[model samples]
Target: MIRARAIIDRDALAHNLSRVRALAPHSRVYAAVKADGYGHGAVTVAGALAAADGFAVSSLDEALQLRWAGIDKPVAMLSQQLDATVCEQAGEYGLEPVVFHETQIEALERYVGPALKIWVKLDSGMHRLGFAPDRVDAIVTRLAALERIEINGWLTHLACADDPSRPETQAQLDVFAQVTAGRPGLRSIANSAGVLGWPAAHADVVRPGIMLYGSSPMSDRDASSYDLKPAMHLSAPLIARNPIAAGETIGYGATWRTPEAMDIGVIGIGYGDGYPRHAPSGTPVLIDGVRVPLVGRVSMDMITVDLRNAPNAKVGDRATLWGGGLDPDEVARHADTIAYELFCRLTPRVRFEVI
Candidate 1:
């Protein structure tokens, strides 16, 4: 029997995509499915997001994964420094990749296969990827000179679109607009945060990542506020339950003790399953759909939860880590991390079943 599993709800995924369409009606949805669809399984969600205009990935192999899975939709490899091999694979597979360097242009020049489409990535203020605003024209010119390639458009990443209170997103948007002025092809600037919080950043292409999987892109809001549904339900079985006396400490490091005599359950999941190791005591876990406080420290393969709130919960009842009734953002807040990391960090040990 599977002790713990992450249930991927494709219906919820499709519902979220509909939300993206509503938010950016004029833009194409380049749904981000990189990091194996944020650990929800890339190929799995691709089928669910068939309505999306295309997919946005992080690497050539990520694109190939979809292609091999029979997903022929346009897949754009997001802004990155490309190598000769990656460029060749991209052309061969009909992928639209972002290019910023002269070396990448040269590699495309050497490619003699089918015609390729490419996007020039400009550093709009993220400073992580993309070419400088001053160098975009030169790079675009060089890329445009390639006989067998199509300059799909310009691309830029927003630094602080997650919170509209920050001015960086607008500054980045301004830089992108000026750099790509009178430029050929379309412009893509919105990620999930941009899709939800910055309508001005919604250019010709909008790539929604975490929000497509049902997590809120902004800190000030929850997913429900955006009409998003929970797409992944993580749950583990309660392995053991024991009555503890008041003042009795629990688990490794003796980090928590019983405030009063109450039953505690041993849940069959922990860091080994990609549950955050640093998740402190009092993090909420849903026991048989009832909220229970996580007690002590998370172990390699187990966790302890106070059953006072779930007095009738049985040893074999499923305990939810997040999703469904519990918001992943809420769980993330308790763990002091974002929902993205929690989704991407799941190990292969956990069973992933599509629903």
Candidate 2:
């Protein structure tokens, strides 16, 4: 079978997590491994980071997958499919749930058995989810009544940490601090961007997601500046090489036309394997560690790359669509998206091999 492969470097993951700890020395690191460790494989990444302080995931199903793999760390589900049975399952696996609204708290009270660890999510700014920060008192009071509930922490999310100059981040931090001011338990407000940019928001815990996987959290910052190494390098072998004449066009829409006779190499990876389809011409790819340019519209199972610089490019040569010598961030930028989407979109059809 023709294989598109991802090389995961466990050492790079360790370095990335270590960088997180260095950035926020006073705060505990919670590695957000949701979306199957952002498409790097949850169980694999979790096991690799077994020394990490804790793991944060999106749902009970994710938490259960970690539990099945023998990861015994403290796990907090950032959000879950709210239901009675799953609430019980969260407790069963020692997974903490984010209680954002009154209904979830009430459900936890009714369905929870022994001890329930809940991270109360406050909507300081990211209106996507969480209870109103001003209503902490009411939410606290409701949770305090449950005999099995242990209010482990106060949590909030940053709306603009990715864009450092946006004053909304500081405003959100101020709001978060105001509400969590006197709370005895842990207070967490740092996502990857928050961990890198907003130091004041790093309270008792810092949840670093993309950064833990060695990708830049902000549009402007380089991941290397943080000493974060990319954990995954996606590559495939060249399948075909052809020389197109000056008048010929390439790919589905014939989006690209050759201006001169040029050698083009076909890489055995495509949108089906999570390579972004919208990648315009001139998007960077790597042939034997030398940069090459993408030449056409990406297809469901293949991508054509310009091999002018790599005159030695051949049918069996390795092509790095992203990862290895070429960074995923560069490709993401050309595609006008974030590294998060690029990483998470990598599908199961691509084989994974840990290095």
Candidate 3:
């Protein structure tokens, strides 16, 4: 048996996608499966999200992985592939590359043979990728001139769509609308946060990433508010139950001390299994559906949890790190990180089982 496992709920995955459809009924969805579907396994996520109009990935390798898995749906490469050889491979594999830089455009021009599907990225505000707003018109013109390359869509990323109070999202949307005004192609701008908060930015396609996995994109809201179910339930078994006296310190560095005599259940999971090492004392773990407080520094493969509330919890009892009753968002808050990082950082030592 695996010491730790990430239980992937396929029904929850599908439910989250359905929630996206309900929110953005008019927009086609490009499910973001990058970072191995945020470490939930890209191929598994793709199969669960079969209704998505397309899949967006970070590289050509990820796009081809879906193809190798027998997924024939359109795969959009969100990052630039400036290498001529990689661009040629993208074309052959029918992968759509997001063209942002002149170097990428040059590579595509040199290697594209019959026809290449492409999404032209515009730098509305994020300033991470995509062409500048002022240069998009000329860039579009140049890309259109290539007969073998088709500009399938114009897309931009939102930086602050998660915060509704921020005005930058609207400003970015305005610039995107202005730049792609008369363009005769699909327009996309919404990520998970954009799809939920900025309806005006939802054009022809809305690419959702975190929301499809059931975590809320907004800081103020939660997944339950959007009717999305948590997909990944991470759990580990209790391998040791030890009696500790008051003032006894547990784990490395003696960071946590027992307030009273209590049973410390050592769970067979820790940073090595992708549990956050930064998770502080008092972070909650679920034992038999009851919340228990973590009492010590997380070790490489074990964490000591105070099992005062659950006296029956013993060796072999499963302790939930997140998901099910305990939300990953809540755990993420304790770790001073986002749910995306928590999901994506799981090591290969952790087993993933789809249910």
Candidate 4:
């Protein structure tokens, strides 16, 4: 069997969902299972989080996949609905489409079918999607005239909820509140960061993504602070161990050199398996349950780790890349990235086992 594998912990997923509920007891959860549950496998995650009020995905196909997997919960497509055909399909599948532009509303207007539940997205502050807040009233009026669709609610993405200190989060929330106040449908503005940091944004519905996978949404705090357990445990085997003399260089570009005679262990995973290539030397990996420093440039299929901290480490010893005791957020920090990218960018070469 391939030693490189990711273990998906269903219990941790459920626990994280419970944490979201604990934070916003009055709000409904639309769990984001997009990007294949951030590479944990969407169907598997949906099964574990079946109790979520709804599942949110990036496309109609993803929502359909969950439905085919026996997930009966409401599935909302967070991305825009591009055409009338997609709008019709969404109605057929009972999937909710997020209308972010005038084109989407027109598409829905043209569709002829049973009423479709739709969430109108407002460009609160992100400016990446959704209509401008000023245009929301006009959009809602047009939407209200559409007889074939039901306005489920209004939703917005937070630009900086991860850092509560940033004034933009509250600014966005204020705009969202002002724009949707007295609206007939539910109003949702919180993502995982909002659920953790900005309680004021926890409106009628909360969409929690990265935090549900046990990663900290905050830049200053760790996941443990929120009692979030990592749902994916990535590990590989040490395929080779070599003794290197002092001043000897290792890996491509000779990015690292030993200051003294030391044992170097080669792990059977790398960027090819979605490990970050930019992860610098001194990044942590776990061998025999002991933390060790990565010693050389991360290669296509391997990474070299200094075994000085774990001399008993031998070939075939298990090395945890992240998860378990080591968090993906820590690894991502060393790579100058976020845990969301680390989890979502995992390559298909890494086998996954649901636990």
Cα lDDT tens digits, model 1, 1-355, are 5887999999999999999999999999889999999989999999999999999998888899999999999999885557677877887889998786667777887787788888888888989877888886677667667788898888888878888899899899899999888878999999999999999989899989999899997969999999999889999999999998999999999989898999989999999999999999889999876899899999999999999888789988889999979999999988999999999999999999998
Best by lDDT: 4
lDDT of 4 by residue, 249-329 (tens): 999998798999999999999999999999999899999879999988999999999999998988988899989899899
Clashing pairs in 3: none
Cα lDDT, model 4, residue 299: 93
Every candidate's CA RMSD:
1.1, 1.2, 1.0, 0.9
Q: Tell me the TM-score of each prediction against the true structure.
A: 0.98, 0.97, 0.98, 0.98
- What C-alpha lDDT do the candidate models reach, one value each? 0.90, 0.87, 0.90, 0.91
Report the lDDT of model 1 for residue 110: 79
Task: Give model 1's TM-score versus the native structure.
Answer: 0.98
Error of 2 at 189 (Å): 0.7
What residue pairs clash in candidate 4, if any at all? none
Q: What's model 4's lDDT at 337? A: 94
- Backbone collisions counted per model: 0, 0, 0, 0
